[model samples]
Each structure stands twice: as structure tokens, then as C-alpha cells.
Target: MCRWLVYAGSAIRPEELLYKVDHSLIDQSMHSKLGATTLNGDGFGMGWYDGPRPPGLFRGIGPAWGDRNLRELSEHLESPLFFAHIRASTGSPVQESNCHPFRYRDWLWMHNGEIHGFHQIKRELVLAIEPELFPHLEGSTDSELMFYLALSYGLRDDPIAGVARMVGHVERVAAAHDIRDPMQMTIATSDGEHVWVFRYSTQHQSRSLFYSRRIEALRELYPDNANFRRLSEQTRIIVSEPLGDLPGAWHEVPESACGLVDPGRDFLQDFHPEPV
Candidate 1:
């Protein structure tokens, strides 16, 4: 299990959400309330789009709380869309490459759950990735594998459907191996434009995921709060937990649901895996 957040809205320094919030991602790394593991100190990573080019990434094989570079970068860099993740390895190695916010071309992705019995299905899943995409696989974590799997299934064309196919493939293979509960994930992906998030599991109990309420409403409630005023009305954030204790500031994403955040509107709908 892990903790992660996706911010898709106004351009602001990452620290505003990664550190300034009461229950920020950095805080969750040391004291997560809903994750399977409380301390996600294995590693951390962030990906953000600053221009028309591909997203820039910063990853480290160290606890996010004590990483001075992460702290400095977060305070200086600003982006309209970004992702940050703190890892609590399920079984993968604690290395820089295994960090989340995996990237390819202009896309970025991260996850907060695992592929149940990953060791049993690793070979099969790896073989399923397309040959061209296989060479780009940079880490052994199931999270990165899921990213490539989605890419092979057309992530660049239709992200939601590609991920659905990826999950379907994993579930089908796990079923053949007689693994009862084969998947658990709260995943986020983006290509510098629309952001898509999915919460699902084969057992019907997925990891925690929440999206922030409309910034306009929050600003009205806290008129004097500079943080709310700094953000634009279209600002949208999805995280593993609420960033603050403010009532109605966050909404838990429903089980087996997919959330899409575009320019000025956000949409939530049922998500079901489709076999490849």
C-alpha cells in the first residue's frame, strides 16, 4: 500500500499540497490513517507538466519526509497538473526505479495498491506487454507494469478503457492461477491534459481515494483562507486521503468508480474491467 495525490488545476508550487496542508502527502508518508502500512518510507516520486513538452520527474530512494531535494523542488516548481507518491513496498525492492509516478512520453502514472499475488503472475503479465513497450519497462514494481500494460492496450487513445483492459487481463490471469482476490488499486494517470483516476479491486474492497470538492465552494466557506483564494475554480485534486479536516472539502471516490477531471468539469462514473 502507498499514499499518493494528483493535482489537476491551477498552476501552483507543489509544496502547497505536498507539505502545507494539515494532512499533506508528506504527513501521510509518516502517519497514514487508512493505508495498509502506516509509514510509507520505501521511496517517493513526483511528476508534473510545466510546459508543452513531456512531464518532468523527480524520484528518490529515500523517505519523502527527510528528502531535502524533494522539499526544495516542491517549494520552487509549479505546474498546472502533477502527481506525487510515497511508497510502502508490498514486496518490491526499495530503489529509485521502483518509485511511483512512472512516466512514458508525455504521460505519467502512479498507484496506491498492488496486484495481489504479483509474484505468481509476474511472468505472465510481463509477457503480455507489447514488444515495443516492453523495452521501456524501467522498474519491477507492479505499478510500472500496470502503466505499460495500459499503454499497450491504447492508453494514449483512451486511458479509462486501456486501464480497464489492463485490470481485466490481470484478473483473468490470476483467476486461471486460482488466486481468489487478484487486484487492489486506486490508480491515477494523465497525459498533461485530462486526468483519470480509478478505484477498484477484484474483492470489491479497493484502497482509499478522495477528490477535493469544488474550489469555489471551499473559497466561499473559508473566505479568508489564502490557500483557497490562490486556487482557480477549475482546480481538482485526488488523493489517498483528505488533505485537511475541513468538512465537505473532500469526497471519497466510490468503489469500482472512475473519476475524470478535465478543463472545467469533473465527472464520476462506474468502472468495469473489459477483457483484452
Candidate 2:
């Protein structure tokens, strides 16, 4: 599994989220306390939306902590929405194409888990993708394939439902191959505006996921903190784990839940697989 985070709120340098926090994403890449792997040094990537243009991506086939390019870019680039992921390869090659935060036009996606026995169902899953979209598939990781699958099922129309449909298809095919517990994922997808995050697994014990508490409340608690003061009240972050140690700073996303972070609201609802 990998570790990732999505930030949707006021435009700010990516470093504010990637490096400023106590247990920042960079820190997690080195010594993750809750991730499946303590060292996610296989690779790293970031995707951010600037204006009306398609989201920009910066992926590297090296540890995030030591990448000077990643450090420089994070300090300079600013966007209202962004995704950062540090990978720990399960079986895929450690190359730029296999990195997280895969993009399609205006959308960006990252995942922190895998589809069990993907090789057993790869052919069927790949064939299910819309032909036009299939040509755009550029990576071999199950994470990227999952992103394209969501797009094929209408992610552009309804992200939550589209992802649910994708999951359903993978599980359906896995079951046909006599595989049990076919899926495990903590996924984040954004269309340059709203961000949708999902946590689910066939075994019902998904990976860790948490979202920050409302910024206003954090401000009230730490009035003197410059970090909280700089952030807008609408800021919401969905991360693989808590970025800081502040009490009430993070809330665990429920098992089998879909979390939506829109303009000024964040909410959760039950998530169930649905056939496309």
C-alpha cells in the first residue's frame, strides 16, 4: 500500500500541507507510523489544478524526502486543490508511469491500497474499460487501471457512483476467478473542484483514512498558531493518516464510507458497490 493526501480549499503552496505538518507526507514517506509499509520510497507524485487548464502533475521515481525538485515545486506551486502520494510498490515496477495521482484531462486520482491477485483478473478488467479511454491508459499498476475504470463508468458524471461501479466490476470478476476478498482501497479523486474519497475492502477492514476537522474550530483552539490563521475556513483535507498530533485535528473516516469535500461542506455516506 501507499500513503496519500488531498487538499481542497484556499490556494496555497503545496509545501504547507506536504512539509509543514508534524508528521507530514514527506515524513510519512520516511517513517510512516500507520501505513502498511514504514518506508514508501519507491516513488512519489503530486497533481494540482491552477486555473481552468487540466491539472498539472509532477512525478518522480525516487524517494520524496530527497527529491530537490519535489521540494522546490512544493514550495513554489500553489493551487486550490492538489494530491500528493508516496508509493510502496506491491508488485508493479517503480517507474514514473506507475506513480500515483494519475490524471485524465481535468481529473486526478491516487490510491493507497491494491486489488488482490490483480494478474488473475487484469485482462478482463482492462477489456471492460471504454475503448477510447483504454488508449489513454499509461501505467500498469492496479491503481492507474482503477482510475481509468472509474472514468469508463462515468466518474466525470458522478464520481462516487462511478467508483462504486468500478469496485463492483473488479470484485465481480475476481469472484468469478474464485478469489476471495478482491478489493482494498483508500482512494481520492478530484475534478479540480470537489474531492471524493473512498475507503472500502472486501474483508471490511480497509486501510486508515482521516480528514481534518473544520478550520474554524482548529483556529479557535490554537488562536496563536500562524498556520491555522493562514488557512481559510473552507479548507478541508482528506489524508491517509493524521498529519499532525493536535487533538480533534483529525477524524477517522468510517469503514466502507465515501467522503465528499465540496466548496464549503464535508460529509460522509455509506458506500456500497453498484454494477455500472
lDDT (C-alpha, whole model) for all candidates: 0.93, 0.92
Residue pairs with colliding backbones in model 1 are none
Model 2: how far residue 212 lies from native, Å: 0.5
RMSD of each: 0.8, 0.9
Prediction-by-prediction clash tally: 0, 0
**Model 1, total clashes:** 0
Q: Estimate TM-scores for all models.
A: 0.98, 0.98
Which whole-number lDDT from 0 to 100 does residue 6 have in model 1? 92
